[model samples]
Target: MYFFLINLSILDIGAISVTVPKSMTNSLMNTRSISYTGCVTQVFFLIFFVGTDFFLLTVMAYDQYVAICQPLHHERVMNRTACVQMAAGSWASGVLNSALHTGNTFAVSFCRGNKVDQFFCEIPQLLKLTCSDSYLSETGVILFSVSLALCCFVFIIVSYIQIISTMLRIPSEQGQHKAFSTCLPHLTVLSLLVCTAWFAYLKPLSSTTSQLDLVVSILCCLQ
Candidate 1:
């Protein structure tokens, strides 16, 4: 639990740091400009951190599932080596996913303009500016990401189902409460993260940016 939480906190800091610092600097300096390379870098690390966050959440759910449902083998199942490998795998997945996104996004020709409608260099906004026929490649990447997220969501749900069943078998009301207390917050955070991310990425793209888009984009970032 501590391993996943600490990794998640670090990922959150990295994710927000990717774009927030630049946005704040621009706000204070009265500038609306980010260089092409800077925008690409921002998009890369943002996706990396965000992807890692989701993976870590999934790991944490599995960790809890093992702890609650198979307490006898918890130590054996989640040994130090296993924990390190899981954490490393999460980071690797994030890096590879981010590389795919960054490569596909920048490979497109930006004929519309360099100006991004959102505060950060988001994929959807970048796609809006793309003029080449290859934009569908990036769309495919988004679809794949959404599919992976759904798979993770399903995995968590299944884990929780077993967890709930196991909790009910426990005779003590306090034990149930203790188990629920540990799981509920993780569930809430996962729901918010997945829902907001899906809302941001899976929604229909608008040809023209609107106030609503800005609001939704901000909400996604803050999450």
Candidate 2:
């Protein structure tokens, strides 16, 4: 689990660093502009890191399930090779997903002006600038991404159900309390991340306003 935790920490750092430094520079310099290349790079890395973070979180949920519910088999199931494979798989999938979204997002013609409403080159905010068909294509890609996240969410939920059930069977009050303490916070964050991301990305843009986009985008990125 420490291995997975390490990867998560790196992803969190990378995700925030991708935008925060440029943001701080802009704030200090009193300028709001980023070169086109810089914006593209930001979108790519942000997608890559954040996408891997989500996958890593899902894998960690499974790690916990195995640790708590199948302790006897934990070593065998999550041996060093298996752990490495899982981590690598998460990163590989993140790269593929990021590449798909990044390519599709920039492929659209941007004529609505380059003023991104949000802090970074967020896919949704970038979509707002498209005069071409980014909405149609990017929506498809975002839905695909969202669907994958939901699948991970479902897998985590099922794993936790097994975890909680196994915890309930622990016979000792202290054990059950300990288990609940561990599970509740993870579940809470998972719920918030999934809900906000789905709402922010999938909701109809026409019905939404820039202010709402700004707020939701902040929630999506910060979490």
Superposed Cα RMSD, model 2: 1.9
How do the residues 85-174 of candidate 1 rate in per-residue lDDT, one tens digit apiece? Answer: 999999999999999999999998889878878888898888888885869998898889888878988998999999999999999999
* Each prediction's TM-score versus the true structure: 0.96, 0.91
Against the true structure, candidate 2 reaches a TM-score of: 0.91
How much is 97 displaced in model 2, in angstroms? 0.5
- Per-residue lDDT of model 2, residues 90-135, tens digit only: 9999999999998998888898877876678888777878875546
Clashes by residue pair, model 1: none
In angstroms, the error of model 2 at 149 is: 1.4
Cα shift from native, residue 31, model 1 (Å): 1.1
